[model samples]
Target: MNTRTRAAIIGGIITSLVIAVFAISLNSNIFRQSNTQQNSIQNNVGITSKLKVVASFFPLYEFARNVGGGKAEVYSFLPIGNEPHSWEPSIQEIEQLKGTQLFIYNGAGMESYISKFMSSGEFSNMTFVKVTKGITLLKADAAEDDKEILAQGGMDPHVWNDPILAEQEVTNIKNAMKNVDPTNAQYYEDNANAYITKLNTLDNDIKTGLSHCKKDTFVSFHNAFNYFSNRYGVHDVWITGIAPEADVPPQDIQRVIQIAKDKDVKVIFSEDLVDPRLANTLADEVGAQVLVLSPLEGINQTEQQEEKTYLDKWYQNLHNLRMALECQ
Candidate 1:
């Protein structure tokens, strides 16, 4: 072959190699850019679709779950089966408050962590709901004074025990749900009405059962039933005052024992969360029976296994109350 022809062929092969390399590089860059765009789209979709909610405790969580109705993600600051008054949320949980959309709480003197959260402005962007916003409140009697207990004297926070107040809570939850998801307003209202109807039925059943009580007075280790007592016209001889474990003075014990003897009080109610020793001792002193009347602060292991709903626990409470008072 001629020299000129050989040189031309060598240059043409080099150029072909260069073009192939350039094409491969360009295709690789395009693929990487496409994948990155897909990832960005997915992340944005997740952020926009997530419905963040943080409930103060069990009752509030249950209410939020009912209203959220699978449309939103709901979580509780207080762990399941842990009492809210004593349980403290961790740093991770506090951080979750940053971008939360809804914050539901039992705001009538409950949630000691609320002030701190509000001060931090963690929930500034979130809409807050106090579930017990419109219920009739009951303050403990003047006679329910221990020096320590009187220091923190306020209205009872266990309003959920009264079905009537629970109906109000359901209403509040519905309002919050509608506020957050206006498009689902009718669904929320319907669910709330159905739940409130059940509450009314519970109220009627409780009233009917308690109507036949041999005595109107009932005793308990924890003062978790002031609202329940006042609602049903039943007298609560609470061994402890408003704050659980807030000192039971000697006079209070003496008075309780005297009343037990006088009224022939059949049963003394005790709670799982609080030490039952006090109630057991009091029952022994007065020959009264000891009964487990759960305060419904949280669900226990057994309750969890049973998948016990709020209404189940509430109806159980009604039965215990009726039995404790020895309803005929």
Candidate 2:
């Protein structure tokens, strides 16, 4: 071979190697970028696909959470330890409602502003579910000043206090979740059944425990326990009317005091979230001790920190009932 021909072949081989290396590097860069983009899109789509569920209060939040499990983002809009009867949503909560896929509320006057919020004509895409929709509502004896509250809806709205009623509320929440995310209906239903079983046990325990009580009547700071009272035939007498913040009339206070004494009540009951002053005063006046009866409108810090479920809290409530009523 000639020297010129040898030089030409060597140069050509070097040029081919350079081109192959560049092509390999370029392909690797493209593959990494494509993989990164695909992953980004998948992560975003996964988050968006999950249902955004907002519950009006803790009990409904719990019901929705049980049904949704890992498939949805559930939030109880009310803060810990706030009474729902007088609470109104802030602008931040209103803004969040716009993005919510499903909103659950305990109707029958639990949330007075719920009707207004839904009627605000904003967020047409969001679906609202009221757990008390089909259930019959009791007339909440409201304070003289708060008569308009009952006039607006004319129902007690504390149905979750009763275990059977809570079971219905849970079913309503599960059905609402199923309606919004039908793909996960079976999953939600199964979870709902599990919660329902817990509720059933609570109901039986309440009935059996309260049935043989030495006394059938108990005094409460507020009228929230009428649903439970109705369920177990334990008469709940409240010093003040439905609104926990409302003050009772002097005559009404005397009336409750007399009723307590006549019934031979050993303990006066107060709610967790409400101030115990009135109950304490009444107990002092009547020469009786005071105990806490959870209304369960919202969770307090201690209860929240403990991560107690509604079922767990109600068992404590049952024990309180047994002690106050002298149940054997």
Candidate 3:
């Protein structure tokens, strides 16, 4: 072969090697970029697929959480230990509802600010679920002095205190979950049914537990237990009006003391989140002991850390009531 031809052949071989290397490097870079983009898209889809649920209070949060199970992410708008009757959401907290799909609230005048939010048209994309929609609300059994305050919005919002009504709330929440996330309808249905079964058992337990009590009337810090008392055939003589924060006038305190003495009440009940001083004073005046009768509106951080549920709190309340009533 001629020298020039040999040199041409060697140069051509080198040029072929360079082109092959460049092509391989380009293909490798394209493959990595494509893989990264696909992963990013999958992650975004995973996040958006889960239903975002925001509950107004503790009991509603519990109900929604149970119904939503794994398909939804549930949040409580009211922090633990805050009184729901007087709690007002801040602007930042309100802004957090932007991407939420469902907002579950107990709407029988429980949350005073809910109406403003509903009318603002700010959360048009979110579906608002009033768990108390189907249940019949009881009149707020407020004190005579607070009659005007109670009469303005006479309906009681503590329907969840009644286990039967709680079942209805759970059903409402389950239906809402199904409506928003139709693909997971059966999953939500199954979870709700299981929780409802537990609630039914709770109702039965309460009825049987209170049936044979020696006393039918009990004293409470506030009128939060009207639904519970009404359902179980017991009477509650509350110190304050519908809300725990309502001022207890001296006259009303004397009135409750007289009622407690006449009824031969052995226990004066205070709530978990309320100041126990009033109850202690009443108990001292009436020669009775003070016990906790939780409203289950919200629990403290310790209880939350302990993973206490509605059932746990109600059962504790039942135990306390049985002691107070001297149940057989």
Candidate 4:
């Protein structure tokens, strides 16, 4: 028990305490860094794991959204309030397509620019799904004067207007999704089946609702309802051709007016996004009321914000048609 030995023992004990504190602080810092890195990696994976789907327009966007459910992120190539009949994607938008896994469009010449895009071979990795693949297209019913405006022998591209064809489109979308992401095949299948069931109900409702109507012929702003009319055994007397923006000829206007009078049409149909002045004039001439008949090409920003869906719009259209046709 000498004084020098006692001092040496105390100093050694203090040195051991300092080393232990340093080691604990170092390990704590290392653990926090590791956790932060792991969280960041997890966040990145969560984002990239979701399938990126690009749809040509609103209906396809909705169908893809329903089919994708939580497994995919769907984007509409056409902006809100824009008509799909003449919408062409910008360079920036085209470039954005490179990042997506699938592109869904209603092909039957619906998208005029799609052929160019497909032939360009720019999207080699992306799978292009034409929802109208199995559905037969009807001849474009353009007015005699506007025949030159629409391409010769053009097929109607509004197949989504018919619930039965919409079911087919949904099935095509589901197939495309499954082909690209087989890991979530069952998930996509379930979601698609649920939507298809809703479509089946819609089909039945439309058939039953229109069966007892007083009139079978209706005046629409454009020839966007051939598939719908053909399905339900009704007829559409459209003012314009396949393109809604086509100018209505004076002769055609007089012709439609005569037909309206002969058929005793109570209502003239206009589109949500089109200029309604012409429809109003026709209505005034025929002593009929004007109502909206949306083609569902693209909804406005307000409708998008309200989360309006395809079925909602179709039901609204049906209600209006029933009112116009004096359906029982």
Residue 65 in model 4: shift from native, Å? 0.4
TM-score head-to-head 1 vs 4, winner: 4
Off by over 4 Å in 4: 1-48, 143-153
lDDT of 1 by residue, 217-320 (tens): 88877677878887889888778776565688799899999998898898988886778899999999998788888777878777778888778887887788
lDDT of 3 by residue, 114-211 (tens): 88888987666678999988787877666343433354467777899999989999999999888777778899999999999999999999989998
Tell me which of candidates 1 and 3 scores higher on TM-score.
3
Give residue 120's error in model 3 in angstroms: 1.1
The 10-residue segment with the lowest total lDDT in model 3: 38-47
Q: Per-residue lDDT for 159-262 in model 4, tens only?
A: 99999999999999999988777778899999999999999999999999998988888998888998898899988898887889887778989999999999
Candidate 1 CA-lDDT value: 0.74
Q: For every model shown, what is its TM-score relative to the native structure?
A: 0.79, 0.83, 0.83, 0.83
lDDT of 4 at 175: 97
Clashing pairs in 4: none
Which window of 10 residues has the lowest lDDT sum in candidate 1? Answer: 143-152
lDDT, each prediction: 0.74, 0.82, 0.85, 0.86
Error of 2 at 258 (Å): 0.3
